[model samples]
Target: MFKVGYFYTDCLVPMVGNNPYATTEDSAAELSINAEVYSLPSRKLVVLQLRSIFIKYKSKPFCEKLLSWVKSSNCARVIVLSSSHSYHCNDLQLCSCPFRYLLTPSMPKNVQNKIKSLNWKEMEKSQCIPGIEDSEFCVRIPGGGITKVLYKESSSREIPMMVLLKFVSEGDNIPDALSLVEYLNEWLQIIKPSVNDSTLSALPWKIPSSWKLLFGSGLPPALF
Candidate 1:
């Protein structure tokens, strides 16, 4: 969805390694060490894509800075696409849909009502201490990386934000990604389905060429 745009360098920083050369085979001539931003002015959308994992201790600071930037940019709202470990889901979670959503308290009531109309499930609070029936419940996302932190920060800062995530296992997450996008489309209506096709399955989506070798190039024939 965020294939084309000029580089947004304001928030760019060397948060990861300092290697000047591209470390992976799929990357272009230069390395990707900073978060990238893509703007779709026609649609008034700005996508901030984090290319690398944040250093463990820098997660909170990064989220704080990101929220500050959002406020300064005067963006109407923020939507985060994330995932969680399917294996970590509780019994109730496993029985229902794998998709879930969260909205900051400051989100507009109309938007909240819209989500409700879609009949989406909210991220469930898990036991703070596992195996203890009476343990306090708290929001936990085992493999969600910075999702929880970012959500909490956005809530406390009163920045209208929404989180859409899915329960997925490791490996081949392309289908999961497509499903999440479809879920988001139900609310954003970024792409409208045909009148004959009420479902999003027929929506025209162009996958970027860069995704060709997503997992990596094929092994050399010489190796065989």
Candidate 2:
């Protein structure tokens, strides 16, 4: 049996004035017109994919203690999905089955740097290109998010992963390699099996189908 736990993360994208994108019964009228809009107000959207999975269980007392901390914390709910019951990136990427997990979560350095800056206006307007839009700065607020993720190391084997995530708004920070691990731990605690368990049984970890949504056209990196 397999299970998936999930949470809702919110984001705001300011539309300058009112939500020009807001649609009324009338299609002919678009209240928003072509204009220079920067430092837009925060707009809200419910991102459906801010999630992680807990698919393996190694009965370590220390892990148990951590699990206790998560349940007590109001931060958010964490869930994990893995093939071998471990979230090890190596295992995930080594899986014989072709997968896209690594492709999605791997945030490029260029993008990550942009996310850290608190001020958007300070950003050079010219450098912001189409792939990287202008007038948008993303920052991720910890403790405020509703979901967490952690990827455990595989015992020996490797697995492939494909991931898909949607940012309801681009105003928040992008998940980094390190940050992704923190959330993964949160999920591990929630779904980790009880003690007295020796080996990792069947777990909930797996590369998901969301990648299809993101790289609908772009090809994934080939695993050698």
Candidate 3:
């Protein structure tokens, strides 16, 4: 979706690590920077792609700086795509859809109503003290790095923000990624379904070449 001519390089977040590595072949050739921003003027949308993991104890500060930048840019809203640990799901969560969304209280009512119309499940609050039935309930997102903090900060600042997340485990996450995108499309309508296939989107998503070796190089023939 962020192809050249469609999206232009906007800015970079320099608060991440100094690894200076690329996550994909396209990025290796065109972008070597860590947190890069791309903008699609036609849609008035900005996408921040983080290519590296954040350093320990820096998530809050990074989120603060990010929100500050958003405010300065005068963006209408923020949508965060993230994932949590499927293993941490509760009984109710396991029985329902693995996808969930969270909206800041400050989000526009119209947008909230639209989301509600889709019947999307909101992220549920878990017991603050695990195993304690009477303990207070709070939002819990295990394995969702920085998502919880970012949501809280955005709410406190009254920034219109939405978070879409999936429950997944450690492994090839390509399918999980596709599922999340489809979920987001339900709200954004970025890709319209074809008349021939009402269940499928018009555009076919191609897996990036970089993911060919996602599980690692083929086993050495010598080993067999």
lDDT winner: 3
Q: Compute the lDDT for candidate 3.
A: 0.80
Cα RMSD of all models vs. native, in order, equals 4.7, 21.4, 4.6
1-224: candidate 3 lDDT, tens digit per residue: 35332212233334433223345545566633566666676767788877656666666778888899888878899999999999999899999999999999999999999999999999999998889989999999999989999999999999999999999999889889988988898788776667787665425656666576678899999998
Question: How do the residues 2-29 of candidate 2 rate in per-residue lDDT, one tens digit apiece?
Answer: 1122221122221222222333446324
TM-score of each: 0.83, 0.18, 0.85
In model 2, the Cα lDDT at residue 106 comes to 38
- TM-score, prediction 2: 0.18
**What lDDT score belongs to each candidate, Candidate 1 first?**
0.79, 0.28, 0.80
Taking all chains together, the TM-score of candidate 1 against the true structure is 0.83
Off by more than 4 A, model 3:
1-28, 199-203
The residue-by-residue lDDT of candidate 1 on 1-224, one tens digit each, is 34443333333345543223333554445334467566777678888877655665767777778788899988899999999999998889999999999999999999999999999999988888989999999888879988999899989989999999999999988888888888898888888777886653546766644566678898999998
By lDDT: ranked, best first: 3, 1, 2
Comparing 1 and 2 by TM-score, which wins? 1
Residue 211 accuracy (lDDT) in model 1: 61
lDDT of 1 at 7: 36
